[model samples]
Target: MELQQLRYVVAVAETNSFTRAAERCLVVQSALSHQVARLEQELGTRLFERTSRRVRLTPAGAAFLPAARQCLEAAERAAAEVAAAVGEVRGRLAVGLIPTVAAVDIPGALRAFRGRYPQVRIGLRVGPSDELTEQVREGTVDVAFLGLPATARPQGVVARELGRDPLVAVVAPGHPLAGEPVVELGRLAAEVFVDLPAGTAGRLQSDQAFAAAGLRREVAFEVTTADSLMARLVGEGLAVALLPSRYAPRLAGVTTVAVADAPERVEYAVWSRDGRTPAATAFLTAVGIDPEAGEARPAPPQEPPSV
Candidate 1:
């Protein structure tokens, strides 16, 4: 039988009058009566004894009232739960982050977001910018912290630029260059260095900076992950590394110096979807970067007229 039929049966039993039950259900008297009658027939039981003076539940009707009430209650609760899961503020959310975030600003952002939306269960994944971008594109993750130069923007993906985290040189303590308060690119270019793996954002940034200076880094080694890069810089004592300043600042055995000429890494965020949905909106607000606010490029300079 339909849910309304069960609800009508319960209401009629409780009110002990078809007229009152119909009014309570905001339906015409005949409609409520018909629904109850349909339910009783479907159940193969006579649920009420009717008389000209009054109406009363039969033994079968009395037995079914509690169960019918329970069924209606269960249905309403199921509807509420589904609504909550779909658009309400309570449920699981998946987020992806670049490695730099675990070291820099994300922990605080996550702590604050958790406090704001306690009912939301957050799942976080961390990796390089390339992988995180792909995850957001593939819908493998709901939202992610990413660096710019994303290889592909999946259709309908939205991005927000949080801020820039510039590249810095990380040299082991006691290294000759560590004592220099402000180490310039010219100095760094001559030093032996452990470079990021070729083709990665970090490596590209390093190459571009050195190329601009008309110098090349003495690349002694290379690594793919930031953690590996940090560990190697500490363990090997062989060469310095170029890393996001936020990550470098957290390492104890390393001295972080802003690369005077290294191109900054622009941090951003990408989400697979968006709208007025509660969790999606909150997720987008937190780490999501604004794309419209990219590095402000200067207008072309006008050359002075020749005499």
Candidate 2:
């Protein structure tokens, strides 16, 4: 079948409407339907079952869909590679990150990358660390920034440690512990807390630390986004929270106290081990990271003037 036919099929399958798919593919409904019909005839099976009310993939369509998408992706990557070989980076860059990432300025980095490579299309996904890591390993995400407890590393991917910071106590400005310059985990454990959802990497850092210290802190509020809802809880004097020191300070209307015996959280940048897209490599470099070494690439020394 033709690549255009595959594209039409995928668009229809995703949108579940021939008319919408044709609109998305910038073709008329009849042309798109004809192409799909031709492909189905060539393969001797219907890819989709169409009713006036709804459209759904047939069993054969379900089987054919994944391979069809892969073929399209392979074709796109091949084109991107040829462009890169000529010193032009043109491809889709899918980036994933945790909500509480603090190691790098993600917005600024993306802006710089966009300015440098206007031809590249960029997409961003915000998710938990574990999910983001898995997306990177699966090649669904080209690059990811994650925060995990010190005891863990991103499995089955190429990762670089971005930075590590101890967890700090965040409380309302008028909270009793807010006045303290430093507080121990045991002391913070005495207070009700707001934290990431149970079993998440963000929450695990504090949980493992408190358990190790032979303390238990009651997490009265569990939130997915720590920067907003969690901080709001802390600022309202509803509960205290343990957050990475680098990120806690940036929260408004809250006081951050150093945790003397806090757990350490590590931030990491991870990518697929199989290979990196040229767009991904360019993004890393634009953000001052070395794609191969997974560290900051040193700047080239200035040349001396010839007299």
lDDT of each: 0.67, 0.87
Q: Cα deviation in Å at residue 60, candidate 2?
A: 1.8
Candidate 2 per-residue C-alpha lDDT over 7-108 given as tens digits, one digit per residue, 9 for 90 to 100: 999999999999999999999999999999999999999999999899999999999999998899889899999999999999899999998887888999
Write the residue-wise lDDT of candidate 1 on 1-307 in tens digits.
8889887887777888999989899999999888788887888989999888788899998898877876774565455457667765655567887666522266776787888788877888877767777766665566777664322322356765555656777887777766666678888887788866777765776777778788877887776657755555654578888777655665566776656666677666666643223454565555433334422222234332111
For candidate 1, the per-residue lDDT at 151 reads 29
Please give each candidate's TM-score: 0.59, 0.93
The clash count for each model shown is 5, 0
Q: Please identify model 1 stretches exceeding 4 Å from their true place.
A: 1-87, 102-104, 115-119, 149-156, 228-232, 273-277, 286-307
